[model samples]
Target chain A: MMSARICDKIATAIAWLAAIVILGVLASFLLYMLYKGLPVLSWHFITGMPSDIRAGGGVGPELFNSFYILVLSMLFSFPVALGAGIYLAEYAGTGRVTELIRLSTESLATVPSIVLGLFGMIVFINYLGLGISILSGALTLTLLNIPVLVRVTEESFRAVPSYYREASLALGATKWQTIWRVVLPNALPGLITGITLTAGRAMGETAILIFTAGTTVSRQAGDFDLFAAGETLAVHLWYVMGIGLVPDRMEIANGIGALLIITILIFNLAFTIPGRMLQKRMTGTRQ
Target chain B: MSATIIDHHRLKLMYDRYVRYLLFACAFLMTFIILSIVIFVGQQGLVTFTEVSPGDFFFNAKWDPSEGQFGAMSFIAGSLLATLLAVGFGAPLGLTGAVFMAKIAPPWLREIMRPATDLYVAIPSVVYGFIGLTIMVPFIRNYLHGNTGFGLLATSIILAVMILPTIISISEDAIRAVPGSLEEASLALGATRWQTVRRVLLPAAMPGILTAIVLAMARAVGETMAVQMVIGNTPQLAKSLFMPTSTLTSEIVIEMGNTPFGSAWGNSLFLMALVLLLISLLMIVAIRRLGRGSVV
Candidate 1:
């Protein structure tokens, strides 16, 4: 009974306005954090050690730990996740086991990282006596990363055209060769996007490492021992701010926060820009 | 030539078998990890019930660790209250944005907005916590005039921001999933865009949207560092938005380092984490059910 013309106009305008507000909020969160933190962010801040009483604190070890843990976790998880992907996409045609795997993946995805942190604390640290080491943290993170990589790789592999599989098989190439030479290359973009997303997640992760990785920022410089308890930048920020001891805690938190934001931005841009380009070429679709 | 063909076939068979074995091993590992976590957390947490009464742990409002009490009701109340407030405020904004993104935005706007949402997700939760701690908590304290700026209100706002990208993306997908012909049918009958969305698309996407809301709630409840920073980690019932409170996650994180490795406090933290794990899995199952229902 209402006049559709006026109704459409008003609704369209409202939706557009709402879109603008959401966009503004998203943009401002990024811009404000960057603006506030960038002034104090520097190479020294990136590579220096904390003073006893906050005169000149640096996140050198935390930064090193973050990258070190990320690399360690990735190295361990990559094979497992990639192999899971291969199975799910190439071999998991239809069965209860495949369904079970999918369920496990979904369930694992939603398991709170904090809980995973606790699991690492109890199992790896307490029982196995890994003793708050980076290896324990890495193993905990591998549990987080494996499900993500499996799903992404599976999805990417499934996205490849069935005809390509047929063509490769028709040419007498075995299934392994076809998967390696043809399907794997085609699925590279999704795999890359997944890896980047996982990397961002692992770098930004704090709750999982809260107990599993010790919060101590190593004072002894250039020590890259995996067995030692080390804090990543995210955990470092939380610990620094939580302690509330130093006069320059705010400055340290701000610098590290900006760096965290920048790494995330880079990871995101890496995923999207390449993802978009590869997707376009694969689909032969114009933007 | 015959010998070479036989040799190639044998090699191919071995390679195929080896690759499949590796892949299957990887697949099995996924299930193994999930089972291991359940077992480990169960072993750590389930033993504590003998010492701490379930009624005391679950129902008592006070959560003083020094007093030898491990009541988590206050934390539960805080998490639920914060999630309720966050969903209340965040859902409308996210759905509206999703409506615009899916149904109204021009291609250029969609391009810009999509990346913005992605960027929103990529921002670390700790950064959100830092910004909230420095800006939001203080603003509330100064303007609202609280002794401690950190409280449930600030925590809710930070949570709302943290969950926005999830809600928007999920709701957008749900909205876009609506069959175009259905929209056209409504439009041809002279219903406005709003009416089509309200009476047709929204109804159709309700299950998906519900899943999105629940997902956001799950994410909000599990959030640790951000809420811990702003909410002051006070173990009290959430009497008001301005009051400080604790959550299962924040409580564990705070005590994880200080507590002895296998003390009663450590076991209690494990129990708290068990509660979190169960809640998340339940939400995921509910989401799957809703997803399945919509298809039918």
Candidate 2:
């Protein structure tokens, strides 16, 4: 039988191999997506109207609707998530009610996106008579955003050194004043990082939007009507390849795939990196 | 001026008392939403049994909405097979990668891999589907001698790639959470690094690794766009991995739009979604049990 030393060397080599393979896969995937998609991208492609049967089509409306819906969903989810987070971190007692609330959020996070889509369909679209509109889509997407936001908010609030709270209370400050003046300011950096990461994920969400958003953009470019069908870039990527009738659907799909990767990279470099640095700086000084 | 200042102070005091209730309502809204999802999805899914029996819905392989035969067995089986295959391919790679990250790699390499895994998670499902469609499907058809290259094999490979981040990050945390003193003790005992990991670390970290695998499985089962794009989405039980098949998720994505609301066809699709929901919830419960077992 081989000695343990020999086995140890082999396992170490294998672990190195595993790490290399992962990085290699990721590098190739990103490079290939950019290589296939970059040449097709132009100003017109980003802003031009989609053609139904023609060769030349742009994803202007789809891109517009993506941002529009993202902003709306964030608008709806952020406040509630903030409130919930504050409660859990500050006010919650270790009781059955708190446990139930935690369980609900955890289960909500795990619920399949498609199941949430169906629920959105029944309640937001069918029951509420909203039809397949941006409003309905935004409301459904809120459910997807809530759990992540709540978790982030709670973590951020808890990270504020408890002494900060104690010091404020030691003064004549009320509970509300202590939270608003001390805790919220200190937790801002972590909150921003969480929100940025969540927004990045939300921008790429397709399944929930596909059902409620109805896979069709308004005829008018940059339409702001909440009732208009909102087909975001991710959904457009799927729809174009799967069911679109355009002659150049392959090119459109390639462009969309590449565009999405570029956006994700930008989000990471532009927001997440800075956000992380700010968070580190804040904690370093405070702690 | 004195009266106004007193009124402002009183108003602030009242706001503090009421704000707690507001936050409580916001937190309670989550529970309300979960209950609503179960009630709404379950209510519609239950309608499937009104026309078709439970056994027929669960066990029958033949699924034809127009013919009034609503058999969901094929889709159910396809989901299980695909999830199993994905976990088989993904878990070992992820665990080893975690080992490398947690115990093997230097700090610099670990930093790079951290962002790389996040990037993997941030990539959307539809893009994964697109890659599988344009690259893997064609490559499989040509190289593997598969007829279409769009089936369980292709779907599982894509899913394996998609779930790598989830498995790797969780397993790495589990390994890292193993007390540093355990490593010191093993080394002092003259055990090799691999032996220490194999005998001591693996047993200690087993619960966490299992939790990671189960969560990955949940993700694979619920995955829709990626699988639907590559799986060819036929409603049949495939004889081979290369043959076209549909999972509950893929089938719902394909047919939900075409069926009118409240019809047998539409309700059946909701039932498929309900299956996906219950499976994920079950995985969460299993993870909780694993956590409890580890403490003992």
Candidate 3:
């Protein structure tokens, strides 16, 4: 009994230690990556041309492709995911079809991103003859984004108070009208936050883009050619580290890492915080 | 005015009916996509057996593909070992962190840690690999005296960190779901906080924690860029933890670009991906079973 008591104290200390260690690791990792990469970052680095065998090159096209692919993928996925989410939240009944949809969603969510990349390679790149281009990459990324968006949409819609729907229905508004007008507006903050987080994630994604997007950027910065090879920043980072022959690949990798971290921080600051504030105000939750 | 209002109402009804079908189609698309992926990848992957025997593909260790060796046992072993090692290290720590958040942390601390975990998740897997390559690889080489310091140990460490958020968040939810009455009853019976947690709370939450661990394992197994970067990308089976090796993901990423789309080599890569897909799907099914078990 006395030993059990001692064990309790030890376990408590161990739990606290685990928390501190995890926090410490995160802090040190961010700080260390920033410290190493900060010197490499500049307007030139952000917007300059990448060198093949040279020392100083910029990631201009890769940066452009990252955001371009993100936007393209989101545009492709949002409507379908929104519709699915609406169906699940508003229209799904407790039946086999709903169960199957849910099971499919969960299964899709568990499918490896790399496998999705392969499927993209086979279908979009080869069978469809899209080649390894921005279009193919965005299409592949759309598959990756769908499950998450659907889940987020469903969750966000479910979070809307029941009374909103009840009140809209009571006013003789049609189901579609009520959903479009009231529930969606109320769910906007959560949806925005979810979308922003997804964008942040997609921006940093590398594996799916690697096979689908190809590794070479177009010579021109901000090239909007759908068939052009689209190497995003994350892929560039991986490429520079792996098989790159450039003299300053290390410095390039460092800069991209720092840039990605900064983008994530801005996402949290710019969208997530504001969205949370809106949610709190609308929900009337002070705590 | 009354005629226009009636016309508008009729139009709205028609629109509403049409939208329902659209939403249903969208929802059905999930099933369609999943089916397409399995069929496409599976069809491409199944071609390997026409030339190579399943016994060789599954059981053989040698995987040259140039001289026509199709053995993928080493890659499979590497993936499983790396995943198991990662779960071994990560699960306890993650569960502890979950317990800390759900039980011990002050509200202010919990607030900070929650976002911190989110940030951890947001950090790209490649970045984790980069850090492992730049920092961890060298440290292991010098201190542990490994040849390249790129192998199972390094891969496992990075993977453990990568999966921490999944384990922590899910397990935390599970811990929180354990009824408050159970805790109070244990406390009222002269049990300490730790005793109550260990004897009552953890048992009740075991199924959830198990789900979290399996999910973490699934993620660890499928992880590509990170494992590829750190695991040395060599196809040979490692004799020790420090020896260089490769997993299915690393091998596919390394060789996929070079192989012709319909060639035996490319087909083999597709087959490896199929194996990974099957493994993850199996884990999901296992989680579903566990979830059902928890209800009883």
Which candidate comes out best when scored by DockQ? 1
Model 1 superposed RMSD (Cα): 2.2
Best by TM-score: 3
* Candidate that scores best on lDDT: 3
Q: Write the per-residue lDDT of candidate 1 for residues A133-220, one digit (tens) a residue.
A: 8889888888878887887788789888899999999998889999999999988877887788778877989999978887875568
DockQ of each: 0.62, 0.60, 0.62
lDDT of 1 by residue, B45-80 (tens): 877787789898899987777888988899877878
Q: Which residue ranges in model 3 land beyond 4 Å of their true spot?
A: A1-5, B1-4, B292-296
Writing each residue's lDDT as its tens digit, candidate 2 over A1-287 gives 36889999999999999999999988888898899999999999999999888988999998899889999999999999999999999999999899888878878888878889999999999999998999999999999999889999998999999999999999967798999999999899889878887887888898888899988889999999999999999999999898989989989998998989998887765787777788888788521
Regions of model 2 farther than 4 Å from truth: A285-287, B1-13, B292-296
Report lDDT (Cα) of residue A85, candidate 2.
Answer: 91
Candidate 2, B186-243: lDDT as tens digits: 9899999999898889789899999889888988998889999999989999789999
Task: For candidate 1, give the lDDT of residue B66.
Answer: 85
- Compute the lDDT of residue B58 as modeled in candidate 1: 90
Evaluate model 1: give its lDDT. Answer: 0.84
How would the candidate models be sorted by lDDT, starting from the highest? Answer: 3, 2, 1
- Lowest summed lDDT window (length 10), candidate 2 chain B: B287-296
